[model samples]
Target: MSPEPLRSIHVVAGVISDARGRILLARRTEGRDLAGRWEFPGGKREAGETEAEALIRELQEELGITAEIGEPIINVPQQYPDKRLRLDVRRVLSWKGNPRGHEGQALAWVAPEKLPRYVMPPADRPVVAALLHPDRYLVTPSPADVDDETWLGALQRALESGVRRLQLRMPGVDAERRRRLARAAVEASQRAGVEVLINSDIGLARELGAGVHLRAAQLPELSVRPLPDAQPVAASCHTGEELRRAEDLGCDFAALGSVRETASHPGGSVLGWEGFARLREAVSLPIYAIGGLQPDHILEARQHGAQGIAAIRGLWAD
Candidate 1:
């Protein structure tokens, strides 16, 4: 009889960084598993140790730095041909002390744009993709203002105006109506060479073969993974914790909002440039400054390390 094949179990880890958009990578020590390979600075979670606690401990032990672990950014499960491994990757942004290699291994702070230059584990690919395109927008046609014919025309106009990604968000419409609109939007976007995501209507998005975008409330325990056909799934994020969770869910991009004041979410506090910069340092994803954004704010957002700026009103303005 043939011998039973080996199996692998899931393990949690973190990608540690600082405020300057630099990631900490570790060189595996000589004589250790996967020696000479470079990887994010983290270790396996011990029993009874929370993921945050595990990350804090790993950073201290490996890099001699005291770290304050933030929310998780990306959780990727990968299988190597030689050894099957499921990696639950997190992103840690805050910490103290200049990092030094405590275990006699090499360490470096790499800029996000320079990540591709380094050799990384196969499991880190999705994490890399998230880093490349961090900001996402959810474009919803106003049902009250536009009829079906007008809506399609508006969508076409939006597409021609460089709205590559969109979400068909018609909340009160009936199922059949939503399906019809979603399919139409998908077809129109395809013709215009844009991408369309259906908001919360997974079945319709699947039927129409469109991407999906999750609302902030629906993020904590997402069941349906973004379908393979969609290629990119995005979400709306209001807090650093939520931003981290969205990244963990393998989101292609995310929108962080209320950067300035807006009517949509009245009285919501604006996280000015300082706050945006702080959050930008916490994760490797491409973040967009949402809410009361205008054309002039785009340059400022990019200066703060954001991928770009996203807005419903600003983009639609004449």
Candidate 2:
């Protein structure tokens, strides 16, 4: 019998950090593959071990720290010339014992902004982008009283004011209306060099030559991949599991939130800074803090290890 082909496997990673907002990275040991490169600490998943459990074990064995794993952040599927690996990364918020290089390698505490300065594994570039600009803006449509012209004007104004990314979320609009609006938004965003993601309208987004943003409700049923031509596909993830699914499905980014309470979803529980930080420790995907974000809070979001702050109100604030 012929030998079986090697199958791709999944592995979990830990983007472990402390309360001071420094990420823990390990230098690969000499003589190992990709030696001298810095990477988020983690290893392959052992049979019957959950992703979280694998991360905890990796941290304890490799760094001598007891990791209190939080929610997952991102799963990166990377194929190198030598090997293929799926990196399931999570955020680690709390842990016991100061991390030491138990594997006889070096460790460092790096701020997100300083990540670019270090030499890291090639698979970590997207992770770096996510860390730098974590938050994503989910732009809900204005009230019915707002006309198409007014909505376009609002979007235009927001784009001009430096809202680099947005999701056009007019769910109540009929299909025809949605297509027209998507076209208009795409035009405006192209003119201003901004990116627009149409909420849950893959076909319409394709027709309009725009990106797609998947809502959490639609995540489980996403059978078709977002069109590759769109460049970036994003998702709204309320929990670690959802974020993992989004990343596993090849989404370029995800919006994780209700970091703060807001009028948009009044009943949604606020995951304050502490909660947001906890989630941050779990994943390596770029997470944009959604729900109740304001412009002034951008720095605070960054401090918590988010890519950036994403907001409906704050991005539009005058």
Q: Which one wins on lDDT?
A: 2
| Model 2 TM-score on a 0 to 1 scale | 0.62
RMSD versus native structure for model 1: 12.7
- Encode model 1's per-residue lDDT on 111-211: one tens digit a residue: 87887677766555545655654234436646655678877776677777777667777877777776787788899887876777788766667777778
- Lowest-lDDT window of 10 residues in candidate 1? 129-138
The lDDT for every candidate, in the order shown, is 0.69, 0.75
User: TM-score of every model?
Assistant: 0.58, 0.62
Identify the candidate with maximal TM-score: 2
Instruction: Count clashes in each candidate, considering only residues at least 3 apart in sequence or on different chains.
Output: 2, 17
